[model samples]
Target: MNYIIIKDSQQLTEVCQKARLADVVMLDTEFVRTRTYHPQLGLIQLYDGEQLVLIDPLEIDDMQAFSELLSDTSVTKVLHACGEDLEVFQHAFGCTPTPMIDTQLMAAFLGYGLSTGFAALVNDYLSVELDKSESRADWLARPLTDKQLDYAAADVFYLLPLYQQLLEQVEVKGWLEAVEQESQLLVEKRLKQVKPEQAYLSVKGAWILKPQQLAILKIIAQWRLLEAQKRDLALNFIVKEANMVEVCRNEMTSLKEMNEAGFDHREIRRHGNTLIEMVKQGQAIAESEWPAKITRLMDNPAYKQLFKLLKDEVKLASESSGLATEFLASKKQLNQFISWVWNKDRNPEQLPDVMQGWRKEIVGEALNKKMS
Candidate 1:
């Protein structure tokens, strides 16, 4: 493919200015995230039908032009499975691409299944076998290999063509707006990074812990999250959640005790003292200050039956709407809705996933009616 590699701000600015005039642009990104809190953006691919541009993020310091291009409302940006791509844009450019559509979400609406891979979509629709051998390439490395370039280019090159098909089908089914909203939700989700203090709520086995134990877990989780964010390291690379729970429950005091418990030596060495300190801080927390006890959804005596009814309603909605059940609502979203309804604290604010956006007009309203 004949593509321009934008290594300088001027080239990027020129290209983005030209792309802004285009009705639609294809977008994708290559990044490394192993052991990191945020994705290390390596490459960005763009195709505006006229020009194919590979943006070398490491080389280009000023990304203002690209940021403006993403934020441009008139020009629609097309992407495939854009959840992670949005993360890169949000972190690097501090903006989400406006007027976007995710081909993956589009596929789900068309009954292609939620988990369809880009390779499969290309092969099935465009009759192109994507070279994915370089999918795991170290994008952060300099002098990207020919295979890596080929792999990266293929990601955005055929997206417009695939999008054309998706757009046509979605429009015919009157689901274009739905797909757009779903894409925006992906962007919003990236911006909703978990706060450090609340990180313990996401840890496994946290629900069963007593309030005082939760206090310890909360402090430890907060410390881990802050440490990870500060160091740009993955949470588990610092200390596993299971280990945190065990340490809190057993009340291990010394580094020697943690080592004897088979804790990872590197983690013990790096964060052992901090972890011990966090336990002490947590124990000092008063009863009023302890985090609220977590109520596991599955613990409800009527959970299975209620879940089955909701799922059955989803099946009916799917058949009626000619959409995938998974597309309508995932198990987690359903659980969220159940939780929101069950909690006495439930109100209009921070509605469950199913009860938001286009879903409200489709299945969410009916689900609410059923719950009522």
Candidate 2:
């Protein structure tokens, strides 16, 4: 397989022209992001059927043409486990590829289980084993090794053919539209800014906090996220959630107390004053102004029974249909359904936005039937 390494604007333009002619293209990216809020795009590998191109973003200044090709509605972009890759593209190019297909999703729709890794999927579907030893190679390093180039090239080279096979199977199974809808959500731009006060919801122990403590933690978490973004560093580097929770629970008002709680000393030394101010601001907010408490529906026996019933039904349906139970309806969806059913006054049609298509088909009808 001949692979073309595109390191300049001219090569990018030439490749974009060829890519625009294809009905679909396989897309993949290589990056390093362990330390940062955003991925550092090291190499972009794309296969448009006839040519395999490895784009060196470091050497190229203008990727506008390539970006346009991605956003073109006429062309479809095929990827495997593409959520992070899609996010990387949106961050770098300010656009996402349209009409995308995620082979991982396709595999699940065909009963290959949710969350199948790329190499495993390749082995199962194509009977080809992928060399994954270079998975952690430094993509940003100059003078790419022959083995590293081959590893990157292999990602997209077989994807075109794999996509063709999956497309046919999904169409036969009549779940193509379902997978497409899910892919649309994956390709959409992630929120650039989230309210600092709402950040605590992502923390694992957030539910353990009282409303007042939660409000304080929310403010601090939000501040930490902003700081991380400003510094282009990971959130934990700015402040870990465990320490934030400890600070809020203990009501640490002074730098001395904050330091003793195992919080990063440097973070305390640098942002302690501002953190104290935010905590005070959070405390000043009225009780009603605090974020609403997350109510767990499973705490009620009636709802728990309903949830179990839904889970059993989903499992039975998955077995009969040869699809993963998770593909039909997730645990979160089941809980949401129970809550909707419990609230008699709430309209049944207004289920969570995430409840759609095959999920709606499998679970929605049963829910409506049970409620009636």
Candidate 3:
């Protein structure tokens, strides 16, 4: 359990140089994002099969060497359930790790179930129980205890061995390419910019709103997201999402009106007037300029039958492909595929979650044939 804390540029350069020559490298990050739009990087765990170290993000001045090593593509990067870590790396180094493989996906391919926790994977595969005492430690705090550092070191230390085992089994299933593609999409998904204008689509009650009300919701939602970004605050901290739906639906014109409607007082007081203006602006738009009403997929008259048919097709594909139903296609992906096919707005570039790359080849073709 020995680890070097790379606090200086000289040490980072040395390890990264060696890491560049490595065939495999495992990476993990510790970050805090309780209040902000971006996760605050605390420490980075890196292991290139030989050199295991913790990169002290707080103490280092230049991270260019480590950043370059991330995108080098020659070395395969391994991580367990790496979605958030990808975000941390992207924000810090301006790129997601290249040639990356998510061992979680590897587990799924090997029938270990989807979304397996790191410690569980380690315990089951490597037969080593991970300490969970520091699971919720404030990684951003300085002078991290020996326990904390050991915990962080353990994150990357066992990843190489676990990945090696997973890779061998996944390759036997001929799913190594599939897992790699899935990992790429996972990174790409996080990298996709959130357009404020399109923000209302994800609101829970948005489908009930009329086109014009949706216009108002769109405006205010955009404002709220932009404000959150500007302030580096969480979106709900600026204006609760429910309030956005409510204000747009009820046509409130002032903070006082918002308060009367039982919206969050602090939010109404803070952005009431600004929100009022956004509503007025939305109302000013021509009727023809409003966005189309979102069609609730479940409400379609043929929805029950269509969805069941899709699921049945997925079940058949699962049996044939020797992939589990859960891993072959989740309900979310099934819904996404139906939406993409029925929505009329979907295009190839905006591919559905389960329809991208290897997924399209394995199960997507059968699903399409069933629906086509």
| Model 2 C-alpha lDDT per residue in residues 86-176, reported as the tens digit of each score | 7789889988778788999998888887899888878877999999999899999999899999999999988877888888999999989
Candidate 1, residues 110-154, lDDT tens digits: the string is 888988999999999999998788888899999998888878888
Better of 1 and 2 by TM-score: 1
**Highest TM-score model number:** 1
Residue runs of model 3 more than 4 Å from their true location after superposition: 345-355
Q: Which pairs clash in the backbone of model 2?
A: 196-222
lDDT winner: 1
Candidate 1 wrongly placed segments (more than 4 Å): 344-346
Per-model CA lDDT versus the true structure: 0.89, 0.82, 0.87
**What is residue 218's positional error in candidate 3, in angstroms?**
1.3
lDDT, residue 205, candidate 1? 88
What TM-score, over all chains together, does every model reach?
0.96, 0.92, 0.95
Model 3: colliding residue pairs = none
| Order by lDDT, highest first | 1, 3, 2
Clash count in backbone of candidate 3: 0
